[model samples]
Target: MKRPSVSDSLKRLMAPHSIAVVGASRDPAKIGHAFIRNPLENGYKGRLYPVNPGGGEICGIPCAPSIADIKGKIDLTVLVVPAERSIPALRQCAEKGVEAVIGITSGFAEAGRAGAGFQRELGEILAAAPFRMIGPNSEGIVVPKSKLQLTFSPMFNAMVDGPVRIMSQSGGMSGMIASRLAKRGVGIGALFSTGNEDDINTADLMEYFADDPGTGVVLAYLEEIRDARRFVKAARRYRNGRAVVVMKGGRSPAGGRAAMSHTGAIAGDDRVVDGVFRELDVVRIRDSHAAVDATAALSMMKWMRGRRVGIVGIAGGFGVEMTDLVETSGLLAPPFSDKVQKKLRPIMPFYGAVGNPIDMTGTIINQPDMFRDVLNIAIDSGEVDAIVILLTFVGEPKIIEAVIHANEASDLPVLVCWTGGGEDTSPACQMLYGKGIPTFDSPAAILTGLEALKAQAGL
Candidate 1:
């Protein structure tokens, strides 16, 4: 058999109508047990069969002795058995005509020479078989839209369906990014943790997500690009429609060694990788925090018209700081034109600075309408491509409402930096988030979001 394409394999793997847990366990501490329990708890509307030699029930579902015993077709099979037993179990799945397999069993390539040899045997089976495999050392996959939680990671409990789709080499990194986004009131449509990349790699997943209508943005965490040509092609195709934000690991020599031990990855030249990302217009982030922030911004705001930004705030000092930060972040903070400043003057206090960073001063605290007026004027003035509003301890519903209304009124991207309110700001922040406006606590974080917007805009 010629085997299936990456897209075809991923379709079955991601949205399988029937799945079998090859090593389903009765013990809760085992990965097999968690895999079954997770999908059931997460509401996987599929035919789930647990394959265990013990021939018992797992979480109320009857277990088959093996894939051969399963009467019906298996769309996907997850192997959680030990390395020694993985090959035989995979062969059973192949015999059963399973469409895809997730090799959740670790101790493959990352486990040293013995593991490498074992992985090669698995690959040899897959090369001649009709089915496709994900990993011999993979964390599994998640499709929130279908409520498919194939991984044993407990992080899927917090998973929600949204526009951002994540593809990471490390399973832990995928969970971390997803958790961080969820905390920021953002959700992901799908997650692919390509551990070891023995069979399916990041490039394959990238091509799949590129055409997925539900995915508005793609976030990736990589240690190395095994096939740079295929990766560049997929990234180019993906970037044509949605933003691709990546965080590359193993940039340093020491980090490269760590990556090698972690996933058997060989870190290539960082300078060459940086050049490729720049040319492809990929938003490459360094830390997990920035990855989450960038993903949220790109997924929510979509894109900015330009790098020019209108900074509006209630506090003057924070306004000054944001002004400096915005410019330093490679974005423009142009002074408001005379005509625009005229519209802003009546709404501002005498002590307020009404230039680029329009400081409403503390007086706006007493008059919330002034805050609304400033945002409207900034949004309508057309002086800047986007707006970043700074607020502190001002949790008034009207303020949040004004932002929501302005965001809806204009095509320009609007971001909020709400800080110092403690628990009081939760409702207001939640409101902004609900409206799809990116909200942050610190000025620096807000700028990080804008930088993502800038990258997506190709500015």
Candidate 2:
């Protein structure tokens, strides 16, 4: 058997066996203390060595003065020291043969002119170095699989595991998006907050995740990319297998200024960015939540080459919106042929129609099996290539199971849109979501998700 070829330095950077935090602090309020608390609290099982010149103890672990004092193999160094000490610290890490350094200290390029100059100097010192660095203003990384939680964010404590790999220029943005997905019961494979792009840029990680078997989708939040050509090439490479969702910030002038202040990288022209994304065949998203939705849909369902959509639900309104969406998006709601309709007519309720939008009305609450019967009949009838089931209310959990079971038998993809009854239907919706069915709470959202999935088909 052969192993997937990953950059040796990147492997150490993300999945290091041993690590040293250069500025471990005793105070709980300090960022340095977070490095200790996050990894320790999250059950990281690697050898941890904290380095502080004071030679004090933090979280019951003794500190080393520097990398020079640390013995054994050191895979990575998390430098949380002050800006004045960050450059020299990188030099020391390089000397110690550290494979990577995560610069968590701020006051770099985003701070202003002098800080930008200092950051340039820091990058110069790392030229052709043995180890790669993540950020000078980064929040660090979290590898849930390896139990390597280097972030200080509290949200990571409850992080879930899944297929999306995150790349962000802003650490807060990365954590917030991944946390949102996690809160929705979605899993995140790895998250890299590549602040300032001092050494390891966004392009490098994208290329790495392209070959990574654990990653099924790539979600990126970018204010600025240092190397457009490299990032595009990486996107091209990753596109051969998985889905890439990019949410580019800084389109307006004010937003551009804010983006520069936020990450110290210039936002390129928005039109040019759009063209690049279009050419690469990647989905360009407008917001974080939509990015999550798209990733969820892509990760769960099989590619739907045929767009003949079928709507099944108790709510007639769901059928209306689904029909409208299909009309607008060039999707089809091809009515069941007379032969198939005649075959299913006796089983379907007399009051509701069995056209493309087979609304069963609220009577489905009484006969839950009727829902599955409708689904199985529709799938077997060969009238539609895809299904949009409106799981409006939870009359019985068995109906939900019926939907799942019915969909499992067909090659056609199924999307469940649970609407109305407000909070009453949430449990069922989440159940479907947990079962890997791109479940949405409303008709509009589900239709939008379907359109996104359709847009990315055969890419």
Candidate 3:
């Protein structure tokens, strides 16, 4: 009897029932300490073991001198020990039937010479075992909904779980994007950093995430992909309706060299990466910022079927700018029908223009419902597939609530581009984000994100 490739691997890799933190430490400042501290901080409800040679206690839990000393079936082990100690530690975990291990130490192939040799030995140990490994230089994993923040970053402790699951080769990128998305009140289902991938690589995780019940969007930031054919197969298998996004780094010669040194992996040809991503229908993004935006939009507005959009903004200048943006991004701002315009004519300001970019005019400042009224009209018109709401100032709770209500009533996706609102906008923007509306700071980003969403649907 054999463990099914997918289930046996990911159960321990992701939703582990019990774990042992192999270099679990005393000092909270140390990465070693994070393995124990982070999980508790995130409210992990599973059994946790701390392993140290001079075992006493870590965070008040009884410590084990080694994995063999631990008294139960260990599902996972987090190796935060040095490179020299990692081989023995990994061997012990595997012998003890530990299903998965995530090594967070940095001194492996990326460190050169002696470290490379150590990495090779570690690889051989992995190949001989029934266990799976993530990295010797990884940052661990975080599954927000499971209360599993297995990584070392305190910034992710308060993060909420959503449909976007991020898997990156760089731990810093995973944290940065997760924090950014979390700050906007967007939920993150899971995040993993696969550094110096010797055993479990991005493709394995991609296949897992593609079928993950919690994930609606999968974002990967790759310096290099270990297996291209496997990646394409995974993409095709899981791409039913979910968006699989990739941001391939190290496109330039110098950058490729840097990536080699950084991950101890070759940065494969960027052109081939692009072609494969296109052929597999994967959304290839350029930066983490855009990646975060794309993830949020795709995860939340997956129902959006068309590229037609309606613009609602306070300033005529912004409206004009957005008009240009729609044209450039290949998105359409369909004209409102005559009957819809007649209905809107009563609520709109006498002087305000109402075309595709429905400039509600500055009169919306005092009469905020006028803005809400326009939003209702645009949504009701059915002329647009999505609505772009740009605000110069976001005050008036009633109008916000009204717009939110209107947005809830319509199937049309409503996106916000808010700028210059200063302090008052933060809470309001957060409200929209919490409701799954993707918000950006500028006209270009809003339209650009809309276009990306449209592109995701192959429009």
The C-alpha stretches of model 1 lying farther than 4 A from their native spots are 251-268, 420-425
Clashes of 3: 2
How high a TM-score does candidate 3 get?
0.90
lDDT for model 2, please: 0.77
> Candidates sorted by TM-score, descending order?
1, 3, 2
Q: Model 2 over residues 1-459: C-alpha lDDT tens digits? A: 121233767888778889999988888999999998899999988889989999989999998998899988899899999998877888888778888889898888889886877778786777757777888799999888888889878866666667888888889888877776665556787888888887788888988888788887788888886677888888887554467788888753333443536334544477667777877867788777677667666665355667788888788887888788787877888888888678668877898878888888888888887777888888887767678888766537889889778767777767777564322326676666566664666776666667666656632
Could you give me the TM-score of model 1 versus the true structure? 0.92
What's the lDDT for residue 44 in model 2? 87
Choose 1 or 3, whichever is better by TM-score.
1
> Candidate 3 lDDT, tens digit per residue, 1-459?
132364577766778889999888887788878889889877899999999888788888978988889899998899988888888888887678888888898788889886878878887886677787888788989887678989888867767878887888899988888887776667878788899888788888877776667777778988887776788888886555677878888754343443536334544566667667777768888887788777666766444578788888778998899888897777887778888888788888888878778888887878877877788888887788888887766646776676678778987767777775311236677667667665676776676567667766667
Candidate lDDT values, in order: 0.82, 0.77, 0.78
TM per prediction: 0.92, 0.88, 0.90
Worst 10 residues of 1 by lDDT: 254-263
Which candidate achieves the best TM-score against the true structure? Answer: 1
Better of 2 and 3 by lDDT: 3
Pairs that collide, model 2? 161-187, 162-187, 162-188
Backbone clashes under 3 angstroms, per model: 0, 3, 2
Candidate 3 ranges with C-alpha deviation above 4 Å: 1-4, 238-240, 252-268, 420-425
Indicate whether candidate 1 or candidate 2 has the larger TM-score.
1
